[model samples]
Target: MSDLSGIWVAIVTPFHNDATHSVDHAALRRLVQHLRQAEVTGLVALGSTGEAAALDDAEQDAVLDTVLDAAQGLPVIGGLAGNHVGHLHARLAHLNTLPLHAVLSPAPYYVRPSQAALVHHFQDLAERSHAPLVLYDIPYRTGVAMDLHTILTLAEHPHITGIKDCGGSLDKTQQLIADGRLQVLAGEDAQIFHNLCLGGAGAITAAAQTCPEGFMKMYGALREGQLKEARQWQHLLSPLIRALYAEPNPSVVKAVLANQGLVTTISRAPHLAASEEARRAATQVLDRVLREARHIGPESNR
Candidate 1:
């Protein structure tokens, strides 16, 4: 497959304060530059954490364009979701025109199609998408799970190269790893250490956006077989990871980013800005992470 290992960030979509609440292209560009400086493996634009659901087509296109431009050669993956096959096919075609590395698509939400049908859904996507496909298996969000059999069957396809595994089932994760077909990326921040330790690939994590250097350091320690160092980093990261999810996802993530002036604390409707308490807790953890980064050195992969 495409070696989808290492820490890939699920970038947040920054919005402006105008009446239209349009996307803040400038901030988005700045965030991209920030991540690039942090040495993240890749970028996933318009993913769930990026508020893809709230953005219109034009805004999403603009956001993708900004990220692509600012990435400066980082492999940027576009997040594709929805139940409409025809529209999705059209969307995939649209994505083909861009220079994306891949598309991270999840199962049809709420519809909960059968396994056989699910197989055909991704099969069609894989066939239509010029870029590689990374199946997003977040059962809680999608309301459906691709059982081990279904995942293995899909893994047989050449275009279906990897998976963003948020199923939260260790057994299923282990099975996919043992099968040796799809490159398994841990989608859950809390499970990143465990996943990497289990011979799984890297992560497509929202939490990594806050402290990309720290996550990369943890990954490097694991790859170098420095279990003790890896554990220490994970221990320090656990609180931040937990705090970021204390209120939904990117809300806390945005708040933390805003503290560093990387992005605003604004979030879209239905997802309120993180409360002061949550932001404070996350900021506290972020401070600790920064302190460690300074003391231990920021040389990830060393």
Candidate 2:
């Protein structure tokens, strides 16, 4: 199985500020390069933060392609989620052709399959997929929760190697870590430190996009048994994380990135831009975090 460990950022899909609102390939590349410089463990393309639900097949393909090319050898996990099995299989077939590290899939949204059905669904996808499968268990968005038993059973599959855990159950999280089978990644940004301290692999974090260096420093500190250092970084990053999710995801994230001149603050229909309040909050927190990170000096980060 692939070592699905460390900070993997679920990147946002940058769109042009135009009437068409087309994918901004150049800006996307820039964002990828920026993350790369921070030395993140990997990149998750088209995950929820990427606004995958809003993009069509062609647009998804284009976005994935852009991410792969600009990733420049960073392991990339393509996001896959849908209710239609046949369509999902077809999408998996295409993903198989690409050089993806893994495919991040969730329980079928809206359909809310039974636990048994969830197992079968993931088993089938794992069998069909060329790359390993990282189960994305976000009950809130998918409207269906995977019981702990369900996840443990799925772990029996060779291709089912890890989980992006947003189930909101600390007990389940601890059990998964203790099981010593699947690699557990904290799906929620706020839980990153908690998850890591419990022996989770790392995080598939959207918040890291705004401050990868701090996230990396936290991870590094924890790994090196520097609890105090890690805690300091976590404290610095918490407010920004909360602010990024103060509105719907990727809005404040885009707003912050826009301030950095990496991407525009434009979202598709039904998803509005971040409020000025959210923008101001994120900006303030981000500035303080960056300022403190600098004050601590590069030696501490290392």
Candidate 3:
């Protein structure tokens, strides 16, 4: 089984600043190398943070290829979501051709399938997928929530190895951790520390991409039973995390990355660029977090 524990960054897709706003493979590779240097446990490509919905299939495949090549040996998880069963299966078949550690999928969005149907959907997918499956339970975006029982049922499937918990229920989160069938990764950035404290595997967080060294330090301190140190890192990182989400996801995240010259601040069409105010706020918070991270010692340095 893939080790789904520790900090896995849901990396953003970098775009060129030109009119076409093409996928910046060079910048994306550089970002991957940077994250690898920061010691993130792994990478989740084509996740929501990656603006996967905006990219065509060819674009998505190209982006995944870039990520896979640049990831070196880091275990990379690819995101898959949609209501179309045939298309999903086809995508899974294509993904099976890659060396992904796992494929992260969610409940069929907008369809709001019955819990039993949800179970069937995942089970079917798991059976067809060569790679292990990590369930993505972000109800708000998916328009449907998977109950604890539903998740437990899916966990019984051998190929369903983990879950990205964004169900927004502390009870559900705790129970999943207690059940111990599937590795539980906190999908919500603010819940990473709390989830870890509750015996969760770790987090699949977009925020980690911004200040990965600080996140690595936080995870490292927690792993070594340094709760107090972990708490300090959490406090330092909270503001920046909030700021990154102050605008729609990857926009502010890209803004911050652009500020560091890693990528352009452009998001795909239908998603606006981060406002100057949001960019300034995120950059300010990021700067402060980096400054404080320096004091936490060399472990926080990339």
lDDT per residue (tens digit) for residues 234-291 in model 3: 8999998899999889899999999888888989889999999999999999888877
Ranking by TM-score: 2, 3, 1
The model with the greater lDDT, 1 or 2, is 2
TM-score of each: 0.97, 0.98, 0.97
Candidate 2 C-alpha lDDT tens digits along 50-81: 99989999999999899999999999999999
Clashes of each: 0, 0, 0
- Sorted by lDDT (best first), the order is 2, 3, 1
Q: Which lDDT values do the candidates have, in the order given?
A: 0.91, 0.94, 0.92
**Where in model 3 is the C-alpha error above 4 Å?**
297-302
Reference-based TM-score, model 1: 0.97
lDDT tens readout by residue for model 1, 192-299: 999998899989999998999899999998998988778889988998999999999899999999998988888888788999999999999899888876545334
Could you list the CA RMSD of all candidates, in the order they appear? Answer: 2.1, 1.6, 2.3
- Candidate 1: where are CA atoms >4 Å away? 294-302
Q: What pairs collide in candidate 1?
A: none
